[model samples]
Target: MSDLATLGRRIRHFRTAAGLTLEELGREVDVAQSQLSLIENGKREPRLTLLGAIASRLGVTVADLLDESAPSPRAALEIELERAQSAAAYRELGLPEVRATRSMTDEVLRALVGLHRELDRRARLAIATPEEARRANTRQRLRMQQVDNYLPDIEDLAEADVAAAGHGGGALTHRTVSVMAERLGLSIVHVADLPHSARCVLDLENGRIYIPPASIPGGHGLRSLALQAMAHLRLGHGEPADYEDFLRQRQDASYYAAACLMPQGAAVAFLERAKRERDIAIEDFRDAFGVTHEAAALRFTNLATARLDIPVHFVRVAGDGAVVRAYENDGLPLPVDATHATEGQIVCRHWSARRAFARSTRTTEYFQYTDTPAGTFFEATQTGTAESDEFSITLGVPYAQSRWFRGRESGHREVSRCPDLTCCRRPDADVAARWEGRAWASARVHAHIFSPLPQGTYPGVDDRELYDFLESHASAPEE
Candidate 1:
């Protein structure tokens, strides 16, 4: 239906529900009865101010009157596919254009939908050029930044689960893990030959979890991994059929795992004590909870936002300057492209995350105070190894909150005017002035460039080879 018709229908419905006649609404909104009638009949479009007045007088929002009913999900998908077919990208993909009509047969529609789905799958599986990946990452980062990296519903559910598990007052332990597994009727089995990338897998059909032996080395890592796997079951997450869903599910699982590892009430109490002591250390938190630095940082953010009422930002960056992961619940300005891609972009060397790599000793924590266009931030960073890659994780808060954190009194400070050419710390000029032609830094190539198609399409894995290996191992004795 036309915009005017939809608006008129909504207005009429609201007016009837409010038991207001045309004259009554007109008088309250200060519009002529004839004009209101004309608008209600779709003969005229109302002005914005007048619409707002009418909506207010009718006890509704202007949007309620203006908004039209959305199309069905499947129909919306069809519309999107049609639009894609008309785009240069789809045309370049060699997919035929699909047009829809009321008289089209069900078989034809199904065929068109199937063809579009196949083309989309192929496009995703195709090796994305660096430029393509960058563009996609930019879009993803923008969507994430717009929300300030908070997922309230998931956090609420996680906190509720923590309370239900009676873990509200203490650090999580193996006993808690065993109790949870038993409560859920899940069997945990250690597998020495699990894939390096796979931490733990949930076999829902068998009510069992298969985890690598390394995950169980007496620290809370084993419990964390088990909880991570159980998150999929507890949250009722299903097999993700798309990349976006896969990322979301993984994030949810990670959040749930963190929540289990650091129960909200206990974590908040710990932070309160740390804040009072003015010694907020990520490592201290990590050691206390038997979690990784990344997990500790994430849990800190959660507490900062949900409990302590402090805004914070956390980032994990690889040696090559690619952002592996990031989260912010504050107005910290991040270096991003027009598309807001945070990953795979070279961060400014002046930022604490990048500066952390310059430390002479990789094990020691590095702290810095940086002044940016947004605000001054106090950051603490440390390096850790993930698989074969070395990365620096930085946790930062606004300068106002720095007094409550450790390393705030550090004298190592820098001024950064990033995403602009005039920034004092220009990598080229500053580095060149320092080293001239003597200092040489070798660039490291990452496996991500040529690794398997992400979202679990093993790029070069032969199905036959995989099947044969599995068959050969089927009767092998378990550890």
Candidate 2:
């Protein structure tokens, strides 16, 4: 079906170009002039017979009248203005609608469209300020906990896609991923100048998915990126409605990619065997799936409670000690601000997440038991480098479940009273007394805190550049 707005603009464009006023055209089509005016303004849907008569009078086929693209630059502007005014974002503003009429100049239309776009942009910024983003993330995290971080629908989809690609037991290979893309009718293309803002761009129009020529950094896999791009289409995602929607889509895509890399059936059987042997480990999971340690740890959370009957928590901490991402259903106490957001919040110095940074060994995973106010938990931490930044991935469970995992017998342990301020946040009395007035250090600032969210259909992407890239490669020979 044609977009009514586009159809209306096209009709008006053709009628004006042919030098026929609404009254004249209506008479030729045997319709009232007022109804014809309403149809031209996109206020009314015309019957098929009326459209055919109008097309005959306009000397064009119905197909031409139904073309999706605007008939002219002015028509495009009008269509854009109409869409913006009708959008929920605009309606929420409670502003009076401006109707484009014959008296409105092209310059005036342009100004109106531009103003609405800016207003829309500002509104989005307000909706997702840093604090709002954190709170939204916190809410999302709680929701994940409700389901034990398991998404059966996505898991089922990934299992189907992986099996269709002829994947058997072991790590999913690039060749298999290519087959998966083929099954979805998408071809992967590598380009050196891929946009930095986008991890991968799916060109649905050309049946091509463009990725950067360089190998994905930070222990990420090219298969994972391609699979994620495919997930968006398979999952029927549209432009995210808001920041929360964006976060959910992103997390779901990541979940789908992980599920594809580690098929739930094979992964569950493998984990069950490890459980039988009492030696489950993230490194082993990572090695088995040929995925990053962080990926393996997160995938474990996706299945642990739901399939293995063991609750778990996963946390990624930057070298500087800020929590990058966190999820738990194991009754572990994590530091959270008033908004309940764990991101950017500092992990306790005495906890395994922070203490792992002090380890001298870089080749092996670190294991520890931490006694927190909530309970005693056993944790396994692994350090990895991604995009030149060092970070640690920690997976933990309640002490009772430790018997089923490796590193359960490790003697390393610590006591934490976090949220108490004195546990890890407060300095020693003597140290504080000595440095209270003598020490001064400037804080490093992050510009992203105040920066607006990236602007585009896909956040941060340059739509024009992407379109040009797609056009240049639209007819290129397939690799």
Candidate 3:
């Protein structure tokens, strides 16, 4: 490849590997998006100042460019690019151009800066050594060991947030919370079945929120809301406090935010009635939350239980590679199964096996003509029939946003745990279609482990909950 091509490829590769989007990285380096694109595409090299800015933001050193070697002309080109970047010639080499800019009034900038500082301070409080994560996980496991029946109190937490946020207002405005979530790519929500005491995973740069699943309102909002709260921290806008305090006091802050985005009182009441009636009407949730049909389905799965006393269990692996929201029951198949995934699709090939966790064996190998895919599927840990209320509910959140649930350089060993042997084969359309039924299928092919492709796309969750949440707030006169 040409030197420019190599240079651009490397920059783009490294930047993405660091987990930043073009926009987020642009903000950090104080460069415009188009200009950054040009540099990454090898159209122009960046100046020394620009290179320093980029490097500092991404937490890397100049040597990282040359660490990987090439033995030919390409090698010479890479050296040149590295030289130009190190000497800071690109800033002056690339023709300077002025562009239209968003008019961030000085007042707004000041307010934003102040808010960023507060977030920074709070994030600092949650920071601990790397070892702390293991310790925290252990602590949490011990706490939950005996508390499978544990459920948290949402109303109490909301009340606490109202009291502590000090930005006191009347009832929560869902709109505000939804807007915040949208900006940060969070999954704003309410959930049920958590052991008390909200928690967060914080690093020097960002934080992630995790409320006890039970404490939230619906059993279904787990992944979305936790994800949204984490976005607030990672994207630099969340108000941080002790995990306990944030959960209790900020629940209302989020509630207020959501209420503003969605109709609160009416939606709550209607949903309450749905729960009382054990009824699920798609239109009702869609209109209430202002979310898509898929999101609405997921949300109602949670809301239905609260409104009617139907119980739904939620488990979400929110990363990019696998099951985004893996809802399960030790019991019967849930009543919903709609997938944009197709027959002979091997989309998860390059991702971790976890991607297909909680997959229906019927879908292990998809069937246009058959009703299921082949895989080591779950047995009903509990029993209930689809026609009866005794059946446990299940839903696989193969949402679009989950395309990013990739594995890191690690976890190679973990891939072996997946029993979908067919998923491990080098995927060919014909191979994929026939693997399950073929008489010679390799039994040793039981587990396939793979890491995520580098520089992968992670389209953040725009959230289905928001729209339905809004829809729930609005009322339609009898048509």
Candidate 4:
């Protein structure tokens, strides 16, 4: 939603607010006054270092600079710039100043700009290509259905109930988002209260996003947070919601990383390859350029989905020790019936990122929507256990799209992967095979996220089902 003009305007407004002139701010950011002027006018965009310099000069967070929510009337120009930016990459080379936009320098810029353009363009078209959008739409519909399944019942729980069941010594409440945020080389902090206080807490470190522990007793906290995520998406670009803010947190981290990995000029040339390749998921692109997984994932997500015709999902899990981290779903019900997915178990949740998923054992399988019940995610309160608040995402992807999570693709190269390389995996760069009593007969194994425990899974009334059913029966609510 943000563009050069938005950055430029924010720079100007903040510079004025900070009581400094463009020349003065440019001096602080170590850029020439004219260059800063060009950037501020939306004719040029600044790199992270420059943006940081500008933010520092303006006395604001870079995240704050990227914050396009509630666009001022002045922000409209930036939106126009974004559109032009799309065409520049797809058609022209976009260096308005360089009449020869397609020159080498222009090619470089277009590569970087191209993905955004593709992502943007696709989202706008009434047509949903049979590619990733079709896949994404399927997932979105399923998730939304799951969300709908649980939304009306939100009134049933109390914030206190959720919080009481929530895990953590409030570490995430205090801990900043270390991985994606810091990797982008931004200066940020974790705050007890957020820009939208009483709604959720925020960590400005790395990227600007809010994290609310579902532990707030009385269920008010989780409900409020859910409302915010839904509202954020509903408002679309330049509006606020907990989900996009969360996305902003990741996207900011991912986008900046993408720029650094493939500078605008260099990436345009890369686009020509995209036409030749299937979809450039993070890993594939990383292979093209040899980058880190996190970096690739971040970049893929930040890429404008509309331009790339790629869909990225904002998948997250909060487990550490105890309740791990809390998750609040806005549109859909929380997956995994009880606790939120934790960091340690991402591989179990998503198979593509880890090596484990390819080894098909009876333990791993896809649960159909018909089998999973209406609610996809289950929020819960736990006590007397470390994993009390910890939960897993529901594995109920319909038979149609369940294969994407497998580490090996059975079919075509995707233009993009939802949740942006969203196959959950262990935080560790590499992983080994270990069995968890949990993956069923193939048995639940603790493997990396990219590796699903070797199977698409089969549904049968096994002893494990009997056990789970028995457990649920024992715990089932009273009439």
TM-score of each: 0.65, 0.79, 0.27, 0.24
What TM-score should be assigned to candidate 2?
0.79
Instruction: Candidate 2: give the clashing pairs.
Output: 218-386
User: Please, what are the lDDT tens digits per residue for candidate 3 over residues 1-479?
Assistant: 23554555566767877999888888888889999989876688777778777877777776554334432343334443344343333355563422212363445444544544554444444444323433433343333323321222432333343343332343333444434344444333332322222332212222122244445343224434543454345334443333333333343334332333223334456666664554434445555555433444344343334443333333222222233333332221222213321111222332222233334442221101101132212111111223332212223222221121121111222122222445455467876697767657444321222322111011111223333433442342211
Cα deviation of 258 in candidate 3 (Å)? 4.2
Tell me the lDDT of candidate 2.
0.88
Native RMSD of candidate 4 (Å): 23.9
| Candidate 1 accuracy as TM-score | 0.65
Better of 2 and 3 by lDDT: 2
Q: Model 1: runs farther than 4 Å from truth?
A: 1-148, 160-169, 214-216, 361-364, 387-389, 422-444, 450-452, 455-479
Instruction: Please write out the lDDT profile of model 2 over residues 184-292, one tens digit for every residue.
Output: 8898888887766778889898888787764654235778888899989999998776788888888999999999999999999999999999999989998998898
On residues 364-450, what C-alpha lDDT tens digit does candidate 4 reach at each position? 322222111222221111111124533222211222322333322333111212233333323334322344433555555444434
RMSD to the native, candidate 3?
22.6
Best-performing candidate as measured by lDDT: 2
RMSD for each model, in Å, please? 12.2, 5.0, 22.6, 23.9
Candidate 3 regions exceeding 4 Å error are 1-265, 272-279, 292-302, 313-321, 325-479
Sort the predicted structures by lDDT, highest score first.
2, 1, 3, 4
Q: Candidate 4: where are CA atoms >4 Å away? A: 1-255, 264-272, 279-281, 314-479
Compose the digit string of candidate 1's lDDT tens values, residues 157-220. 7677666666645567676676787678876767765554566666565566667675455466
